[model samples]
Target: MSQFKIRGGKPLKGDIVPQGAKNEALQVICATLLTPEPVTISNLPDIVDVRKLIDLLAALGVKITPHSPNEYTFQADTIDIDYLYTDDFRRRGAALRGSVMIVGPLLARFGKGYIPKPGGDKIGRRRLDTHFDGFIKLGARLRGNPGENFYGVETHSPLQGTYMLLEEASVTGTANILMAAVLARGTTTIYHAACEPYIQQLCRMLNSMGARITGIGSNLLTIEGVTSLHGTTHRCLPDMIEVGSFIGLAAITGSDITIRNAGVPYLGQIPSVFRKLGITLHIIGDDIHIPPHDHYEIDTFMDGSIMTISDAPWPGFTPDLLSIVLVTATQARGSVLIHQKMFESRLFFVDKLIDMGAQIILCDPHRATVIGLDRRQPLRPATMSSPDIRAGVSLLIAALSADGTSIIQNIEQIDRGYQNIEHRLRLLGADIERIP
Candidate 1:
């Protein structure tokens, strides 16, 4: 295991080009199994999760060739579908939550698919019931052993598209059902579908591969099943979550940083949400430039009351950035409520912030009220451990901008998302080192 030892209180300044979206890359890679032709993907973030997914794909007999660095061509012409029953498949597949998505394509192409319970962050209870419900709605029968934590699906007939409303806006669940719906016999009308950028990218990629899909950015999606899908080249979009992380990093550390190649259109409600926190972004071409500033003030509600920033479905502030926003709010002047409505346990990380001397009220498992210090007293650094991906990065941000040296363990969680995070921060003048 490795840990990061950071010396805080230095302003990070430089240019950072965001990596390709990890969520989009995961879905796109799985889409390769829909066809036997070569599907090439470029600008993929070289993160641990992506690499693990690649390993899982290779195990399934997908021929993944590296055309160049950060680019690969995936061919599933000789897939070993039986590998899904192996112990290796179950262990590795359960490592990341996104691994559950492989079931859709595998079941669609082959007649059977098997998967263990998927694992990722422990932020809240992520139910796979909706995914199973979607599969059942499409004519697949599922049987699982509760003691073994293993699941299996088998279907002899082709999946029949039907009208179904998702219980909640589950991102991976939407992608799984979307993939399955593409090869079904009829039109699949999905209401309450997750229309996040990753899901939209998956839909667009499927359309590019000859699957007819409409309602790209809406809660309701219509997908027309095609006989077969052909492979094509698709580039993954820039990770807006990472872009938001950089924005928070710049503001809290009082740095001037430029994030290049950021997909501005995909950053729905992000810029405006941060602007309410008094963080300014200068748009120059495709780059978002954040200038240096010592103090930031929180914007109040229209009634001249304390403001609140919360997460919702697409076109709303992203839940992924709530942790970053909480850390940024600690350095701003005034008070704001950070409401994370999606996940119940996400607010538990505020205890670490309180340990650093920031004023925070942990109202419940889903909400937190932050009163910014306005740089009055430097946050006292302490030893900490990363709990999850987003919370891990938020802790790193707090540590980097704190008063003294801090050590953060369990950095593998951070590696699963961010690409070369320590090196990137080092380039931006942050005193961070990785110790093994």
Candidate 2:
């Protein structure tokens, strides 16, 4: 267990490149299982969750070759499908939630896939029924041992394409279903699908590998199954959540920083939402530049109601960045409501921010009302524990702007998402150090 000891009130400067999208890397890396040919992925984020998935793939006998620090060529020419039944497999598969993504490709290519109940952030009720429901729709049977938490998705025969109206626009659910549909016979239509850039990238990558998919960027997706898929190179986009986090960091700490290669086109509503918080940012081609600001004001509704920033599906603000937004609001002018609709308990971190002298009202498990200090009251540093990945970094951002030294334990949560976060922030002049 490592912790971050950070001395606050130091403004970070210089350009920092965001890591390749962790969510996209998870999807694309899992897609590698759909093909036996060499699939090279570039701009892979060197984060814990991503690395865990790579290791799981290797454990399943995927040939992995590292070309550079953030690039890998995966060849799943021969997979030991029986490995899914091992006790070691159960333990490894349960380590990270991304482990569940492997089941889709395995079920489509081979006839069976087994996964233990996945482990991840304890944000809220994140159900796997959507994933298993999609698998069942694709002509697979879902099985579970009476006493074990393990799940088995088996396809005794060829998967036939069918129409599936996803219960929710779950990103991982859509990715899993899409992977299976690619090798399925005939055509498949998915309504209410997740059309996030992550899903779009996965769709495009699968297309390059010979799967026919259309209606990207929309809730309706059509996939024409191909008997087999070849391998291709795919480069992940810059993590938009990291970009948003950096923006909030700049605002909270009054820092001047430039995010390199931010993939501006793919950052839907992120910049505009930050702008609503009165943060000044400029789009420089593919990069985002955030200038130092001593004070920023939260915008209210046009009809004179309190400003409410809520998480929604694609094209709306991402739930992953809501934690960042909440922390940034602590120093902004005026009040705003942070609604974490998709998950409960995410707003529980507000207590830590409140302890740092931010005025916050935890209305419930899903909502928080923040009355910004407008920088008049500096946040007092305090020791805290990281609950999850997003909230962990949000707390880190708060620590960067607070007045004294703060220690954040369970930094492994932060490492699960951000790649070399301490080193990256250090380059920007942040007074942060990791303590084991």
Please give the RMSD to the true structure for each candidate, in Å: 1.0, 0.8
Off by over 4 Å in 2: none
What C-alpha lDDT values do all the predictions have? 0.91, 0.93
Query: For residues 1-436, what per-residue lDDT tens digits would candidate 1 score against the true structure?
Result: 8999999998988899999999999999989999999999998999999999999999899999997757999999998988987899989999978888888887788866778998999899888888889999999999889689888777999999899999988888899889888998999999999999889989988998899999999999998898899989999999999999999999999999999989998899999999999999998878999999799899999899999999998878889999999999998999999999999998898999999999999998988999999999878898999999999999999998898999999999999999999998899999999999
Predicted structure 1: clash tally: 0
lDDT per residue as tens, model 2, 1-436: 9999999988889999999999999999999999899999999999999999999999999999999879999999989998988998999899999888888899999978889988989898788889899889999998997368899899889998999999999999999989989999999999999999999999999999999999988999999999999989999999999999999999999999999999999999999999989999989999889999989999999898999999999988899999999999999999999999999878888889888999999999999999999999899999999999999999999999998999999999999999999999999999999999
Clashing pairs in 2: none
TM-score for candidate 1, residues paired by index: 0.98
Clashes of each: 0, 0
The numbered model that scores best in lDDT is 2
Error of 2 at 361 (Å): 0.2
Give TM-scores for every candidate, taking all chains together and pairing residue i with residue i: 0.98, 0.99
